[model samples]
Target chain A: GAGVSQSPSNKVTEKGKDVELRCDPISGHTALYWYRQSLGQGLEFLIYFQGNSAPDKSGLPSDRFSAERTGGSVSTLTIQRTQQEDSAVYLCASSFAGGNSPLHFGNGTRLTVT
Target chain B: LAKTTQPISMDSYEGQEVNITCSHNNIATNDYITWYQQFPSQGPRFIIQGYKTKVTNEVASLFIPADRKSSTLSLPRVSLSDTAVYYCLVGDEPISSGSARQLTFGSGTQLTVLP
Candidate 1:
């Protein structure tokens, strides 16, 4: 794909339900990252994957939040037993395998837990 | 990760120039300074990235000092549509053995271009 793509642009779920957000990175990109932004807040780093291996997962908020990237192209973030405070925009970005490469971001999925 | 600090908000009028500054006192030698602009319901878009003194692109210009402790993003001829949150990010390098690009974002500066 030309740009990063995220699925379910908007999601509304009950407090205890589970939600999954998908992200498809650009073609040939080897680095994928997930970030969360609360209402009127800065972007919070969630996880980072280089190829199919996640080198960093320290930023995941809690045990309920987990993510996996398959084939080094697509990634999924799952939140189990979501809470009301989990309502936010989940942004996905992908970059080439270097430090100088700028990350291209997707439009993000807005999750609302009622 | 190098911590960054920027202004909370800024106000500018149309046709005026806006300059937002970011301070990163603990920036590493290999760290690169990058700026991103985000609108109300969209993802952040890259504005400029600079590693040294200065870099200018079509959209914005980034000015870094000799010490590399602080940088400024210059937006020329601002308009109402230029109102957005600007994030200054440092540390695009690999900190550990197999770390990918790690970007630490602070509360960005909100620039409002008034008509």
Candidate 2:
């Protein structure tokens, strides 16, 4: 719609449960990004999509973390076997393809691993 | 991507002009300086961006010098609602880093506008 949108504004999961967070980027935007922010901390890059392809996946914190984007519009970030340390606000952002294009961010999904 | 350095925190009173500066000593020729502001419980909002000289928008102004090593974000007539964390980011391509390095906005300056 008008801006980047994220699903389940808040999510609480058990330690071993899996969770998926979805993002709908601004229409026609070719770049999407995922970032995590712990309480009182700066943002940590997770992964990004140039269209539906993620050029790199090494930024993921662990093997259990994965992300995918489809239709160059919607993207999902999945966390497996959640840990207490995984609790943080997961943010999604989108911008035009260029590097200098400013990103439009969504209100993040605050994931709490209990 | 160019690494950015900024202060940890700053304080200003209402109606005062506030300038937060960011230093990027190794900024590349293609790098552009961008600024973002975030409040508690919300995502960051773009403030302004610049390559050199000055850029002004309804919300703020970005001033970059000739050398491009440093840039400043100037907020005019601050108010309590302007209290937030401001980040300075310098980068070329968002996804071009591949697996080598990740784009980052370093610990930002926490600006508190006292009423």
Candidate 3:
């Protein structure tokens, strides 16, 4: 099966504007994750979703950042009133969430807030 | 989750075997070490994983000492294409309770393969 897929390989928006990043996890994968990678930095955990279980939002940086996984498959990450600091590569990953399966990641959407 | 520390960067010449070590001094008994590789503009790709002793795949080899506090990723005969950032992560594999956790990556080590 194909790996995780994320749309809008690149996105540019004004600092005060809002933006949405989408992720389509691998078919049949029960767990999904979103991470942020700033230039020359490590991957920062953002949010995670596991089946019908409540999504974990503890990693989200601020109220302006939110995410939702619809139908337990596709997910959308929205950033409101974006700040320049929000500029980074947003990566989406998915796995079986059991037996210590490794995560498969998408190419990611590079968000640049001007 | 255990914290991992790796060298900020390393330089090697093409065709040389490179070994990058990661330190997780506080690793737990249940923790398993995994390594990932990332090229520019691409998401990370899993390389190798191991609990103790040695584990090898077509891509790389993982060596963990009995102490379990550290692990090393060894690239065999690296090439220019092997230049990338390598990350090491230590996580409690999976408990019998069917619980799972997110993987935490450190500021990976950047490997430059020079010709």
Q: C-alpha displacement of B35 in model 1, angstroms?
A: 0.2
**Clashing residue pairs in candidate 1, if any?**
none
Report the CAPRI category for model 2. medium
- Give the Cα lDDT of each candidate: 0.92, 0.90, 0.88
How well is each residue in B9-52 modelled by candidate 2, as lDDT tens digits?
99999999999999999998877888999999999999898889
Scoring the B chain of model 3 against the true B chain gives a TM-score of 0.91
lDDT of 3 at B58: 92
Rank all candidate structures by their DockQ, best first, as comma-separated numbers.
2, 1, 3
lDDT of 3 by residue, A1-114 (tens): 688899999999999999999999999988888999999899998877887453466788999999988898999999999999999999998888666678789999999999
Reference-based TM-score, model 2: 0.96
Q: After superposition, how far is residue A98 of candidate 2 from its true place, in Å?
A: 2.0
Model 2 CA lDDT for position A17: 93
The TM-score obtained by model 1 is 0.97
Candidate 1 chain A has its poorest 10 consecutive residues by lDDT at A94-103
Q: Scoring only chain A, what TM-score does candidate 1 earn? A: 0.97
Off by over 4 Å in 2: B95-102
